[model samples]
Target: MGPLTPDNYELVLGLICFFLIFGVLGKVLLPRIERLLAEREDVIVGGAARAEAAQAEAQRVYEEYRAELAAARQEAAQIRQTATEQGAAFLAEVRAEGQQQRDELVAAVKVQLAADRVIAEAELREDVVQLAVELASRIVGEPLGDLPRTRAVADEFFERADQAAGEVQGSGAHA
Candidate 1:
């Protein structure tokens, strides 16, 4: 060539610059990029492992809560059964005691009725004897003035009284 052109010189310089820049970038920058990518991958893997461990711990706690709930239900059932038994026992005892009191009250009433009947009989006998004496004195018109006759009437009245008392006592015993 007689003289180098400006365009040809510029083209040659641009090619040399491009080769130098690519060579330096490949040697120095590419390894650093690779190391950064590896670090990012390690961080992602470690985070996934931690998340899995947390999920397992949560499941274990849930199982423990379920077991405790079952135990509580069983305990409540036992307590209810015991209370029911005790209530039944207490009711039976109260009923027995009430029956005993009623029986005692009935027996006392029967005894009091018997005692009142005996007292009434005694008083009736006394009144009958007095009326008989008064009627006999009026009929005789001597007021049972003679001692022997009076004594005989009195003895007859006493015998009749004894017979009536025996009959009443026999009837009461039968009843």
Candidate 2:
């Protein structure tokens, strides 16, 4: 039967094997494992830092966008104000131009009316002279065919009548 106690050679062999395994784990396997763990931790921490930086950058961009939008709104208001002023000026100018045209039309109409009145007065005088000549000829029991003589006598009579009317009006005004 085998002894309960281990032999010296077997004990020495076990101790040597244990030391070899311990040395390999401490010098080679353990260092490699620790380096891998450190690398993993660095990756995790760096990823978190990058996420925070990206978030900050995004916030900055958002603020810049807001500022640009505000500026655009302000510029739009200014443009509207300028356009309103220009439109008002243009409207005023158009109104003034229309008024000038109206005044010119009124003046032209007045001048035309004066010319028509003069022409109508001359035609009325001719008709009145012809009718007077016909009536006189009928009263005298003769045809007064002398139109030139009748027209000269009628014009002289109207001139005296107009002078008398002017004198009356002048006297009334003095009174």
Candidate 3:
């Protein structure tokens, strides 16, 4: 017989021992291993589902945050626009009031100037009449002093001078 070959009795004993071991492993260990594999697969699937749900929730929150931020920006822009309009209105109101005050001051100054001019004209007329009377007395060599007649002559002279001045001013304006 060859060195590697077994005898008939040894072959039969080896076959019997191999079958006993295989049967014991199948009956005692296989079901427990299958149950552990199923439980591991379930945990993996459940973890994936939880991760997906969390990601969806995060996305929703991010979208909501973006919407809120946009709303806040729009509101701020509106506030700025309103403030600008109000400021413009207030500036216009202040400018209008200033213009009104300036116009009032101009009118008051014109009235005061007119009153001063009347008083100056009256004083000049009186002085001119006195001077004319003294000059007439010196030239005639007689004290013929008549105040009323002198004033009448002066008024006539002033009327002619005013009419001449008006004509000159009118011609200047046309030019």
- State which candidate has the highest TM-score: 2
Candidate 1 C-alpha lDDT tens digits along 5-103: 557777789888988888877877877888888888877887788888888989999999999999989999999999999999999999999999999
Scanning candidate 1 in windows of ten residues, the lowest lDDT window is 142-151
**What is the C-alpha lDDT profile of model 2 across 10-94, one tens digit per residue?**
9899999999999999999999999999999888998889889999999999999999999999999999999999999999999
Please give the CA lDDT of all the candidate structures.
0.82, 0.93, 0.89
How do the candidates rank by TM-score, highest first?
2, 3, 1
Question: Looking at model 3, which ten-residue stretch has the lowest summed lDDT?
Answer: 142-151
The TM-score values for the models, in the order shown, are: 0.54, 0.71, 0.61
Model 2: how far is 62 from its true place, Å?
1.3
- Greater-TM-score candidate between 1 and 3: 3
What clash count does candidate 1 reach? 0
lDDT of 2: 0.93
All candidates: CA RMSD in angstroms?
6.5, 4.5, 5.4
Question: Cα deviation in Å at residue 22, candidate 2?
Answer: 4.1
